[model samples]
Target: MAVLLGPPALAADPAPPSAQGPAFIDWSGPYLGIEGSGGASFGQHTFHGTMIGGRAVPDFKTGDATGRNDRSRNATTAVGGLFGGYNWQTGPWLYGIEADVYGANLKRPVASTAPGLGYEGLDPEFSVLRAKTDLYGTLRGRVGVAFDRALVYATFGLAGADVRILATYPDLAGGGVASTRHDLSYLGFTLGAGVQLALTEQLALGIDYRYLDLGGGGRFGLGALPGAAGGPVSTRDASFTSHQMMARLSWHPAGLTPPPETEGTSSPDDRFSLHGQTTFITQGVPGFRAPYTGPASLIGRQVQSTTTATMMLGLKLFEGTELYYNPEFSQGFGLSRTLGVAGFVNGEAQKAGAPYPKLRSNRYFLKQTFGLGGETEDVPDGPNQVATRRAIERVTVVAGKFAIGDYFDANSYAHDPRVDFMNWGLWASGAYDFPANLPGFTQGVMVEYNRPEFALRAAYTQVPKEPSNDVLDPRVFERAGGVVEFEERHVLPVLDQPGKLRLGLFSNVGNTADFRQVVGLTQAGLFADINDAAAATRRPRRKTGFYVNLEQAVSADLGVFARVSANDGRNESLSFTDIDRSVSGGVSLKGTAWERPADTVGIGTSMNGISPSHRAFFANGGVGLLIGDGRLRYAPERALEAYYALSLNKILTVSFNYQLVVNPAYNKDRGPANFLGTRIHADF
Candidate 1:
């Protein structure tokens, strides 16, 4: 995905005028919207010529060993974007100009489509070709007619896109793979039509169709493949066209006012709460030293970006009961698709990434609180939380799909990646191996007891079916993860500063193979493959760990935090990253000393180690959840992160960050990488 995209600009406009005719919908004013799109492509694809080891073949038919052509295959996928425009309406007629950019994954694959000439035995070879477009944008003019609360419109626009072509095939002569890649900028045009229905004075819903014609002309150098030498120097061209359908919702800035400044500090009466937020983060790494590479080693250079937008809805069902649901849209990829580094540089990156935005219900849970009859304290209004007074000593129960991190291992100075830290080692316990799906979310039941001096939390949740896998197990009790944590709060004698200490014990029960077991079995010939050992050993197994988290406030404007975690290294990591033991700590400073009270600065560092068997496993060519250098030089992986945040306004903040990773994935031969990143976040 493009790394330059940031969050859309937001502004408030006066409510649409009702003077036009109180009852007639006025389709004029500046409006912003979010859309979900899905579409397909229909275009002609072909191969013009071929050459094998300097020998030219003027005419060759494209086909594979199967005697079939899947090239020019139909392309279908989903897309997401944001749009804004200003409209002017006169009676039932309206005109406007709009601009929008989308996250997209449009690619077609061609395989075994070239022929090897003049090579007797190496005939019927194989090669692969991929045409990819990650992102595109449009600027269009719109004309529409309004009939009461409904509007019909047509749009025409200029479009531009990022295009890439990749081809890979076997090198028959050298017994290796030969590849070629071409990246370019494409300019095209779009035509579309749509209808909108006004749902309220400041809200509307619409659906539209677009035909995008991104004409293309590019050629690739083909390689020699095994069914004989497929080709040493072959070339092919490209064509691009797509039909897209989109659904959108528009909102006026005045539709939802932000919470007051004192919302979280003072008590307020509240039965319902609605809030929304979005964050965009982009990262890049410059060139570095790497004498060699493997399946899981971080490349020397790369840039990537990700975007997420979420809406929170909370309602009080009764006195001590509430329900909350969070819906979200996420797009883009992590560095190297979230591989190579043990403590990855981007905490927000997901292992399962999509070329376009994907929408899903992130959290849906029911919470009930039981008072134990003590002094009461006011809880703030925010995402998934309602403003209310709760007993200082109480018991709370939550059930449904959620993340276990919501209730445990919290450090005021370093917990949330969105606000404080961007490194996984800093924001979470790298060795905890907490249960989760690809996006780090799981289904579970959690209970907590809170008192003025201390708190105890516990939960049982579903885990991924296998290491490096995205799907969570459906049988909760049969394959589950559980944890218990205890936290103590105290005040320092002279500074009178507040501080907390937490200790957590966790365990996972699944069918994961022990590192030693797999290696030993493969050596003894009992197992056919070391990588497939987990399937052979199907009995239940347990992995356990413990962690200590500490956070203290040196003053109202400064805080320091530290964490130490360890887990048994015999079994594979059930979730989380690829570390078996870790220690991390840091200090945070607010700019009050410099008269910029809204700014913050922080520095943190971590060292991650693996168990002997885990190290041996990797040295033997076995791969883990986040690491595997094919071979290992065996060293503890170390990471350092530093960041600064500037509050631009009440609704937005911008942050800059830098990281140093030494011996990534515990391999000493490969790196000492430097990564730089920027984050833009908005909340209400």
Candidate 2:
């Protein structure tokens, strides 16, 4: 009974502190900044039940003969959104509050054995179910201590959420469906600690951790939800919580300059710098599904939850414009390196390390990769964290290109936009930087490709469909089709400044050429061969996508940029190919108000939408700000942003959101929301 959670879309923690400058308007003045981020969410729940009667029959322990309890569902979904806020500082103790709200998606499906709950007693076993969680905003307070080159801070706040509970029941004696829905309010608290470590006058490194407590929560029946067996049973509400940790290496907008007094004879080899960032995060969501009201065939629902993680390492080699790789280090800053090696690992799981009751939801990626393999790197969204653990997994290499371990196909655009981070595959990509004969803008082009695979893991300790089953034959791996993509970029001087244009082309080909289709029967006894239907076809599937971007400074406080992308996905199975495309564009604004210690303010926004789909037209965008000076740099951290997405056509959509960041998730199983929704991350 594995429960797949949501994607990593929203971070449970608030945004990071802003970088600052001066308080007055002189050579340097104080300024504010804002930012927003998005990712996949992978937190979820699960529940189970036994037949007590009805369609389960013979009173074999299935439950009531009325056919009121005996159904179940295993549900999972990929969700994402945006949030933003503002910040202001006076002295050492930078102080500010921000709010982030989400308007994206919340989906939770279920899987079950019992047709529905068969409640002959006051408490029904478990069967049909539904889980829905949505939130309005998170308000936070900030306080911190500052040292000459360092600062420590703490934050606290409340998150208001709008949640809905739904359960369905099937008629066993006859044929029909019964369902109920509940709308509720939830209150929670959050706390986090962070530190900034200054490495040089112009560079700094930092790490932060945040904890979120959603309190003891649950709905009616089972432990808290009502039992379908008979009368009302003592029930308790479900509770959810998360924790996150992040590290970053940052550079000031203004490059590091040497002291005027030592300018003349300063050493020429002393101006190099480097930085690194890593993160771990985790979180969970739990609840129950009811099946007693309508359809006599409906099965009862039970309790369930899921945990996941996201691990990333980013390296920055800051040298002068003419950057090159050092053979000794096998790494390059800006120049081409003869050869180099890099590592990338991403993992995810449902009902990770816990017990599966009855309710469950399966992710589409997991269903597509259950078997039929070519390589792990062919899946569109990359690899599931648990799948890369296979001893045979190895890095992929092609002429003039190098990829560490397994990689994702860069060209698979057909499924790119809908893919969730929770079930993401792993990838390793590398390319050589070419020497250019251009000036002002650093110009280089490299060709690269990736292979993305799919796989997942869940706890087998839970009760099996057949009692006495000790060793549950857990599904260790699955194969999804693969993709290949090529990318190229050239930086150019726009209005005497640096900007650039990037171009990419890709294709997704099913690696079933030499693969076999494999299917398994779960304890629940349902055919889990969903992946074989559309993915393992003898006909091939292909996808191609492209994008172009431009960035320029309109003023010290105004910047503008635009990007356009298009994708074509063709499935040969039905001799019917679906062409899906999308285009996005946006801008950025940056400047400082009273610059001191390098504090500054910034804002950015982007507009994106998909061209065609079976759904509707969609659009999304957000804004953000920053407060502290040189507090944290690089690390790709965003302070605040709000975005909205909506469906206009059967396959097109529009989205909007507002976001604020106080803290982020550290571990996949107990961290902040990633904006992507619920996610699962596993590691060896």
Candidate 3:
């Protein structure tokens, strides 16, 4: 998120803007920069005698008291931040002031045990120390000497840091462990020197080293002992120092002199556009409910990773017709082959079953638009769009092999699993069981009518050849799915923000088994297994469902989204998950208050349930694509997820996510689980 502060560079300077050129480099003006550093911190702490009953216990010293309790630790760290400053230049001397803040992962823990400090046969003495430096900032003044295209500078600054300390004892007399944490703020000093080289009038790169001393001997009392009620029995002092080296990239927008005008003008070919994105996600559930008596219980404590790369190419073939193609490469499997949870943890974790990377022609489509004489809007050239003006009142017809979700059930905030919520139910209407292949796509045709305030959309897509099949049925007339949706967009006058609401009706016809039939056959003892009965009863069953979606912008930096969907549970799930009903909602917040506008935080929850017939089949040992806990203690599957995404730069982002799932697989007998995830994504 670095911003260049200078004007455009002059193409024809009296001389070239370089060290060897005739023009002298100007090191004046304000600049914004970003820096990354990797370093280590060194620190030491000293402990005093234990305090009990508001008095020092002579025999309870940590280690004979003469600095024997002193401990030292070192930690490796990584830090990154943004910086802004202005430089004043007079002749060859340069002076500047800069301010910056950084976030760091720097922590160390120390522990010790004492055998002689026990009370009533209980070892009541243990010392545990934990210290960390989470954040730090600097306000500095700089002095430098400038060369033609380079500058060498020295800096001194007032530095402030936040440090955390924790002390704990395991054997508290009555029961649980006793612990206390202290958050300390320290003001110190920093000194550094660096050299910068101008790559252009607007861009420069530099490397710098700094020594930071966060002062020493900040004393704090440790109140209460493990076995004895006390106050101020022991005291501790903590300090930290670090040597850091960072590489910086700075942009001076005001220093960029405009280039000379050229004689020829070339217009971009806006009719053709290409865009691509790549996302890599790794997620793990450290522990969950154990394996059940059933055949398809979830495997607890597992890690899985997935990667997807997609290239979207588009061409405007005619005034009202356009064509799009998306070729994608995908690798990796979901946790337990995407099993155990009715609402799976990762939406992008397709059922590809590929142990290695596989390439697929994911989508190809053609769209034609007819204008009905209305306001015009400019469309950006990206992905499937061409840079052109489009009539607000238009009818569009699309025929393609693509994911039905690409057009229908679209949500402005929650639909994209790559960027927004990642759970299956949160990303789409789970119970719709929309037609698709194993990777969630199918050949489809759609029609849409649009206006300033409302729109109507409908689509019919090919269903899988069989239940959970990896290929589409191909006989679109016999095995297919259709959906129609109406959308309304309006402004909330009170909030002064735009919002959209959508209602959709969908139906799928596929060679699927009826849940009640499977249960009925199992009870009749005609077949001992419900799956066998289900296979015997396979036929083209029609499942109908509907969904409601809403997205509201509460403010410029916050938004809310919600979805509720349900389907008739008579037929087996042909695509997507096993849930017959689902409701999900969440809010996304941008980090504008904290000043990192590119960062985002989101929290969401979903509840999924099966119909009576579907539950009975599972209770009688029937398995769907992802879930089958043999016998069922039926309970709705519920999950809560939250994530924080930090934008390292324009093309890269790192996100940390956590999900708590209750009654995974809709089996009350099985666990409430926890899933942690990390995602790295890049787009261009």
* Model 1 RMSD, rounded to 1 decimal: 8.9
What would the per-residue lDDT of candidate 1 be over residues 333-372, giving only the tens digit for each residue? 6787778899998888872265545677889999999999
| Ordered list by TM-score, greatest first | 1, 3, 2
* lDDT-better candidate, 2 vs 3: 3
Tens digit per residue, CA lDDT, model 2, 7-63: 111112332235223211111112122211121222243322222222222223455
Best by lDDT: 3
Candidate 3 global lDDT: 0.75
Worst 10-residue lDDT window for candidate 2 reads 335-344
TM-score of each: 0.73, 0.31, 0.63
Give a tens-digit lDDT track for model 3, residues 303-332: 666766677888889888899999886766
Q: Where is model 1 more than 4 Å wrong at Cα?
A: 1-68, 72-96, 99-267, 525-529
Per-candidate RMSD, Å: 8.9, 20.5, 16.0
- Model 3 regions more than 4 Å off: 1-269, 291-293
Candidate 1 vs candidate 3: the TM-score winner is 1
